[model samples]
Target chain A: MKQVLPKADTERAIDSVFAAARGRMPGAGLVPQIRARAFEVYERTGLPHRGMEDWKYTDLRALIGEVLPLAPRPNAEALVRAKVSAEQVSADQAVKLVLVDGVFAPELSDLGRLENEVVVRSLREVLENSATEAIAGLVLSTTNDSAISLNAAMATDGLVITVADGNAVKRPIQIVHVATGLSVSTFTRSYLQLGKGAHAAIVESFVPAEGASGYQANDAIIALVGDEASLSHIRVAADASDAVNISSAIIAVGARAKLDLFSMTCSGSISRYQGFITLAGEGTKLSANGVNLIRDKLRADTTIVVDHAGPHCTSREKFRAVVDDCGRSVFQGRIVVRPAARKTDATLTTRALLLSDQAEADNKPELKILADDVTCGHGATSGALDDTLVFYLRARGLSEKDAQMLLIKAFFGESIEEITSEKLRDFVTAQAEHWLQAGR
Target chain B: MALLEIRDLRVGVEDREVIRGLDLNVNAGEVHAIMGPNGSGKSTLSHVIAGKPGYEITGGQILFRGENLLRMEPNERAAKGVFLAFQYPIEIPGVTTMNFLRAALNAQRKARDQQEFSTPEFLKRVRDVADSLNIPQDMLKRGVNVGFSGGEKKRNEILQMALFEPSLCILDEIDSGLDIDALRIVASGINALRSPKRAMIVITHYRRLLDHIEPEIVHVMSKGRVMKSGGKELALELEACGYAQFEDAA
Candidate 1:
């Protein structure tokens, strides 16, 4: 006989919230039907738990004890606080698009000099005025995960950006999400599309206002790269000390396209960054890299899945983690080569540095190849700092702590250097250094 | 007072004693060469002085200028004028040689209550020293000892020895993997640092290196003890006759 158990408190609360908020959600025609379907999927699966293989190391059901109510619309005071917080992490020489408490704030964003090259709209406006087919296309999912389903049903507002054919956007587009409320949750979703031969750079930054704590942020981005186009996407997650963050990126690369994606996580009490990328066209190139600097009791995870459905595609994935005190880091990478993906080349490498006996690291790599002519390899390692290297530096007149710091910086250098933009690279490096200083 | 003093020194690793009842004295402005077989503890003495860990001092006392030497950390000992040129220089990736040199120099200087070097001043000093050693500017920009050849690694060690300007320098098998041309270049670099107020201890197994460095005294070691002590001519005699006589004497 099949055993049945009562619904958890958070699950029941989510059910009630969905029932009360469905009629109020902004969307006409197919949008509401899509939302209902997404909600049904969430109900069937419930919250991801330890029993699921994908969420083995990070049990979201257990970690998220209770789901807080949806955050209220930002008031004047909240906008002021968000502005101050967003300025600290805004990338230099980039157009800024600010989202305060999950709702797009046009007054705080600067889309100057980009009016002629691209088209941008808020997700709420698109849902309210755009065609049903366009609305459904914007919310398409590459993977059927429970958390993403939850996001599809609850996300209120985000950006919808598009670049025309052969248009090379000179400056980067930065989307900054600032949290200014306490004990609330925010869900935001965005979509980006590039025409043939188009080039663009996008950056996503998640931060918190001063004195704001205990917030939850669930954000998602969907990107489509056209043939012969190139795109560079960088995400920086520096949330509050007591915040819970879950972000996802669903990307597809077209024929002969190039994609460079990088992410760095230095804060947040519990955070997960997952990516689902597919090579839909032949002769595509992809590079994905990440770094995690976690301390105290904080936890960070980077999970990625790359599907090579086209022929002669090449992909590389590298990730590094530095764990200190009782912190924990998890990395899970999977590569799949379809039967048609002959002559595919893929490699994945992950390394972890444990600074104390209590620090923990978990790494898992999987490969599913249905083609005999493909080449795939993976490597994973987790250990403490090398003692020989430490002694060598100490003998050269550096204190023990300085020697370890230098080595830790070097450990993170490989992944950070892979970022194409020098400005972004230096900014990420400084963030890592700040984390090291705080740990000291 | 002697620059370095060792009185009845006995050292052990695990249960095995490597240095047993060894005594030696080094005075200012003198270069002493200690030659021995593989297991005669010549390297152990240098490591103990430079404060490498994992060695137990069963019974020993070492003094530098009338102060106990074993009571300080490796960095403190280095700041107090002790340097060791390792036989195999370690390769540290992602840290450029120039940056490492600056960090090490500034740290030692700060420990002695000296001001840190400004960027321009440090760069000028490094360029001058590196040019004399035939180290190209490109090599300094590369990772420390990373992808460096055997002779290049040895020359880098000499470059550091010149920059730190320590009072006591210990060279442990520095000539192990150098050709004649490379050996001459490294020897000249080492020769430039000799001073009336400085001392050096050169540990080797062959007499080829001694011909260029020209030590003032020679000590033959066997079975973790000094079998004989004499002038520079002792190195040649041992090279010709081999270590059998010294092993039998011990």
Candidate 2:
């Protein structure tokens, strides 16, 4: 294997990662070859900079600064001490899967009582056994996206979940990722395949273990929903304050399939959550919503792209960002309808609230419709809280802080109420309240 | 001492003077009505008294129970037994009425060095007050004034007044959007809270509301200062004679 000396810090960081993972990296046959190809692509592009349209608001080159070597695989002691945080927003009946430091931990996971129609396997195990055709192809191998390419090149371990046709999972499945060590970089890639007519709900959470700091985590999740399948996906990233988290979700919806995706980001010094969704068949429905509660020097970015390729599909995207103190928040949503996709109904709305004078919020909603008969619209709003409303509450006897708090809660109340799951809604609400109370 | 004393008060909104040299005195047991044509600084007086922001008191003294009222913030005034029923109550979409009231009540209590009410005790008190004001329980459960009718918002304002039990209450244009039935209900709600230890300043444009909740003093204001001070019959006399004469007087 020829070693490629790279120039940029992000690229040099990748070379070091490849050097460190010598022969122990997962995968065999086409998997290793695919990883090498991904590395080649990543080396060619380096890290996405400020010029890239998709990376405009989130400049990884500048934001990431210097990427460290891949986190040495968690040791037995580290795994033993790692526990899912108490912020699990799942019901008691949920089937939980735990990933420590980007590696699937079977001891922490409960797979014994999984439904007969569902099959869950470790991604690394599947890759090492040459049984990677289905999982490998199911994953969206981004050729140009440097982040996902880097994720693929350094992918450590994650889950491969398959739901059989027409089987509805009675309990929700939670994939909780707990970062246990400090000053380490972790990459995880997961693939979920839902057969025709299958229905399931999956929750993914990223939270660092107690006192962990300066961890960099990159995660890519690819899901393929078959025709008539319904999937509810919720992702929450509550990392340590000094952590850098970059998460991406790539979903493909088939004919008549429904995808309800929601994400909430609460802590993290620098974070970006992006979603790439495609409605491929007719009669598909997509609702993608997000809420970000960020304070201090945190910079949170949420970008979503919904591609409507089939006629008569409906899609709605809503995002709310609350930036406090010196925090900066960004929301970018784009809905694209192809020329043949007539009768498409797509609406995108993004709103941001700036809490302090130094706080900043940037919202951009775009619509590209080549179909003449399609109904597509986008709206964006960014401003400070209404002074009159604050005065109204204060005049009613609420203190200044309490008045502001009440208005902030009400601002997020409408969007949080849109969550389909009761427990998840409560969890998001509590996280938002936590952010509100974390003031300057 | 008078409950409220406004001595030659001068107030301005932005670059224009709104309330110029306004003087009024209200005893502990008095209901005063200030009426005039549009833009007569009636709302200005109410807002300045309640300490709403954006008002510059260039000259004057406003003393509440012998304490300088201008030095207090809006919430400080509220905690110090002052309430203002906004003519156009702002709709807060997320904070439920129940939550708002409890927080308000507890804030006042806390400022007064009183123990906060427990959840059950607060709910019982709110239910009792809400029942008397004809406020449905579900309305209290919903967001404050969100999607409320015009009359419902007015009633909610009165409900806040009832719950807070302020010593000096200022109702600004409280009769603007009420129908006959809602007016009667609101008037009775105000009448129920009237006591010798409390005073109210009702700013209205019509004589109908004055008829339901009769005022002890009526002052005709024009431009900024009061042009005439008389009894409750003055409201009816002004209603018949119109405020053209007062507008000229200013």
Candidate 3:
């Protein structure tokens, strides 16, 4: 006889939340069925645990002892708090889309200037109208990870952006998720589609309102780049100090398409960023990189899976982490080349700088190649800053603290330079410097 | 009082004594040279003076301008006008040479309670010094010592020495990898910074560098201690015959 174990507290809580929120969840036709199927998967698997291979370093079952209740709809007070927090993370000269407590706030968003070249619709409206095939296929068909499943079952509202064929959006579109409630959870899902020959850039920022802490944020983005199109996506996770943030990105590149993705993580007590990218068409190019600054007993993990399903594709992944004062950082990268992906060129490299004796860093790189004609390589390193370098800087009249900060900045600067937009690069660099300045 | 003083300097690394009871002194406006073979503690002496970590100071007293220099941190010593030109300058990728120089200069100035240099002022100062040392503007734009040739690295040391205007300059094997042309250029840069209020302690294994920058006093070291002391003529003699006599004496 098979033994049946009791569910964890978080699993039960999540089950109850799903039972209560199933009917209220937006979407018409098969959307409700899809949501129920997703929740069933989560219930069967429970929260991701160390027993699973993918979640070896990040065990949500053990880390998240209890799950908080879903955040309520944002009231007027919450709107004001969201505005204050959104202003701190919003980029200059970019179209802003604001989401308060996982619910899209149209009043706080500025999409009027982009109405012509870009079509913007609320996910809730799209789901309610039953015109959700695109979103459903994008979110449900990509991966079966329990976190993604849980997000699909609970997502309240997000943006659906599409660029017309051959159109070029000059300014970047910024998505700002502001958490204004403490000790609650919020879920959001967004989708972006670029038509053939279109070019655009997107920036996603996750921040917390002043005085907000101990919150949980689950967000996901599904992006598609059409043939001959180019897209640049930058995500910044700067949540509250004690918050738990889990975000995922699913991206697909079409024939001859180019995608550049970069993410920076500097806040939150516990955070994990999962990226699933696929080369869906021939001759696609992808550049994915990330930087993590973990300090003060915090834990941050970045896992990326790149699938080269088409021939003559290229992918490069570079990640850097600076861990200090008992902080832990994890980087797991996997590259898969199908049999048809001949002439595929892929490489991954991750490095971590540990500042204290108690700091920890785990780097795992995996390559699964089924093609005979492929060039693939990966390298990972974890260690403290070079003593000689520190001594040299100190000998040059810089204090010990200043010397370390400069070296740390230099460590992250390499990956930040991959950003094509000079303004965005500068903005990211300044934010990194600000994080370093706010010492542990 | 002497500008720099050392008494009974005994240094060790991992329980191995490297400098045993060494004594040295230098007054302002003087150039002193310490020449030695490999493992003779010449470089160790320079490192000890610069306050590099990992070397245990078993017994020593280093004084600069009537103050106990050993009590200060490396940066504090740097701010107080003590500079050591490394034998091998570190290569720091992703940090531009211009930014590094600015940070170093401003840090020292801030420690001394002086105003930090404005962008234009800093640029002008760096340009003047770099021009004198034959360093191109493009090199300044690149990472410090990244892909720099041996000559360029030595010349960069001289450029920094000129910029900081330190009172006590310790050149630790600055001529190790330079050709005769590079030696001349670097030596000329060093000569340009010579002032009556400043002093230099040049450490080398060969006498070729002394030909360009003459020193008033030369000390021959062997087995972690000074075996003999003499004038400029001693360097010429040592060049004629190697440190065989000094090693035998030790």
- Per-candidate Cα lDDT values, in order, are 0.90, 0.86, 0.90
Number of clashes in model 1? Answer: 0
Candidate 1, DockQ to 2 decimals? 0.74
Chain A TM-scores, per candidate, are 0.97, 0.95, 0.97
Interface RMSD of 1: 0.8
Pairs clashing in candidate 3? none
Every model's DockQ: 0.74, 0.78, 0.82
lDDT of 3 by residue, A287-315 (tens): 99999998998999999999999999999
Query: Ten-residue segment with the worst summed lDDT in candidate 2 chain B?
Result: B91-100
Give candidate 2's error at residue A374 in angstroms.
2.5
TM-score of chain B of each: 0.98, 0.99, 0.98
Better of 2 and 3 by DockQ: 3
> Candidate 2, which segments miss by more than 4 Å at Cα?
A1-7, A84-93, A112-117, B113-138
| Candidate 3 structure quality by residue, lDDT tens digits, B32-137 | 9999899999999999999999999889799999899889999999999999999999999989999999999999999999999999999999999999999999
User: How many backbone overlaps does candidate 2 show?
Assistant: 1
CA lDDT for candidate 1: 0.90
Give the range of the ten consecutive residues with the poorest summed lDDT in model 3 chain B: B156-165
lDDT by residue (A301-405, candidate 2, tens digit) is 998999999999999887888888899898899889999798999998888889889999888888888888888888889889899998988887787788888
lDDT of 1 by residue, A1-440 (tens): 96645668898888887776665466767887788788888887777777779899989888988887788889999999999988888788889999999999998899665657789888888887883766565663425788888888887889999999999987889999999999888989998999999999999999999867899998999999999999999999999978999999999899999999998888999999999999999999999999988888999989999999999999999899999999999999999999999999999999999999999999999999998889899999999999878887888899889889988998898788888899888878988898899889
Q: For each candidate, how many residue pairs have backbone atoms clashing (under 3 Å)?
A: 0, 1, 0
